[model samples]
Target: MRASLSIVSLLAGAVAAAPAPKIPFVTATDVIPAPAVNARQSASQACFVIGSETLPKEVSDVAAALASSVTCDKSATTIANVPDVTSGSTTFSSIDFSQSSQTALQFALSKFATANPLADTDLQTFQDMLDVYQATEAGIRSVGGSLAIKVPKFFLEMQVSRIQTAQGNPPTAAGLQVDHLRDKVLKNAPRESKDLLDQVTQLATVLS
Candidate 1:
C-alpha cells in the first residue's frame, strides 16, 4: 500500500511538472497581410472624409433617391447593408444607377470640384480630401459604375457607418475598421496624413 501511494504521488508530480502545450503564436501576417492592412488603413481615412465631409449634403440625399429608384431583393434593405467581406465579392448590384441618378451624381461631382478648391495651403486634410474626391469621380465614370462607386471594403464600411449615423441609426461594426486604422495611422502613416488623424479617430469614438 505504501509503495502504491508513493507511485501515485510521483505520477501526479510528473503530470503537474509537465510543460503546458505550446499555443501557436499568431503573427500579424496570419490574420491580415501587411499590404491589406495598409490598404484598409488608407480606405478608412479616405471614406471618413468622403462620407463625413467631402461629399456635399445634397449628394447623399441624391444617392438616397437613386437607391430608392433601383429594384432590389429583400437582401437589399438599407444603404448601410454591404456584402459579406469574406465572400470575395467586390461589387454589389443591389443599387443600380438610373440615368437620372447618373446625371445627378455627375452634377454633384462638378459641384464638389467647383466648391472645394485646392489653393496654396499646407493643410493635409484638404489635399487628402481632393485625392479621394478625384478617385471617386474616376470610379463613377468607370464602366457599370454605381452611385456609391467601387472602393475598398473598409472605405465602404466607413461610408455605410456615416450614412447610418445620419439616419439616427447606430453604425454597424463602426469601430472595427476605424479603431484599427486609428492605430495604424498613429504608428505608420506619413506625418501629413497623421496630422489629420483626429478626423478618423473621432469616428471611432462617435461610432462606437
Candidate 2:
C-alpha cells in the first residue's frame, strides 16, 4: 500500500508539469546495448528532463489526455479511484484500505518532496508512463530491432528520477520487481511502441 501510494501521488505530481520537452530525430542506425534493466530505466527517465528541453508533441498529447481524463472523472480526486498504484489494475477495497496507507505515502512523499521536489516529480511521471511503454515494448522484444516510445516528457522525468534515486541504495527486493516490470517494457515493446519512440525522436529532432 505504501508503494502504491507513492506510485499514484508521484504520477499525479508529474502529470502536473508535463509536455515541455522537445523532440529529436535520428536514424535508428546505432543499436545501443540493451541497457541493464535499471540502466535502461534510468535512461528512460533522463529522457524526461531531456524532453522538457526537447518538448516532444507525443509526450504533451499523453499528458493532456491523462489530465483531461482525471478532470472528467469525479471519483479521481478520491484515493479509491486513483487505484492501488502498487496493485495490478485493481481498485482498492475501500478508502479505509487506502487511508491506512495514505498517511505513510504522503509522509514519505512529503519528506522526499521537501528535500527533492523536482526529483520526486520526475520519478512520478516515469513510473506512470511505464504502463504505456511496456505494452508497446513487450511486442517488439521478440522482433529484433530498435523500438521507439513517445513518452510524455513528465513521464520520462519520473523514470529518470526513480533511476537516479535508486542509485544510492540500489533498491530493495520489491523495488527489483518494479524494475522487472520496467524491463518488460524495454524487452517486449512492439511496433506501436516503436512508433511512439520514433515519434519522440522525430519530435525531438524537430524541436531541436
Estimated TM-score per prediction?
Answer: 0.22, 0.21
Residue 205 in candidate 1, Cα distance off native in Å: 3.9
lDDT of candidate 1 at residue 154, scale 0 to 100? 31
Give the clashing pairs for model 1.
none
Displacement of residue 2 (Cα, Å) in model 1 is 89
Report every candidate's CA lDDT.
0.36, 0.33
Candidate 1 lDDT, 91-121, residue by residue in tens: 1232222213433233222222211122222
Model 2 superposed RMSD (Cα) = 32.4
Q: Show model 1 residue runs off by greater than 4 Å.
A: 1-156, 171-192, 206-208
TM-score, candidate 1, is 0.22
For residues 75-131, what per-residue lDDT tens digits would candidate 2 score against the true structure?
A: 332221222221123222221222443332222222222123323344443444443
**What TM value does model 2 have?**
0.21
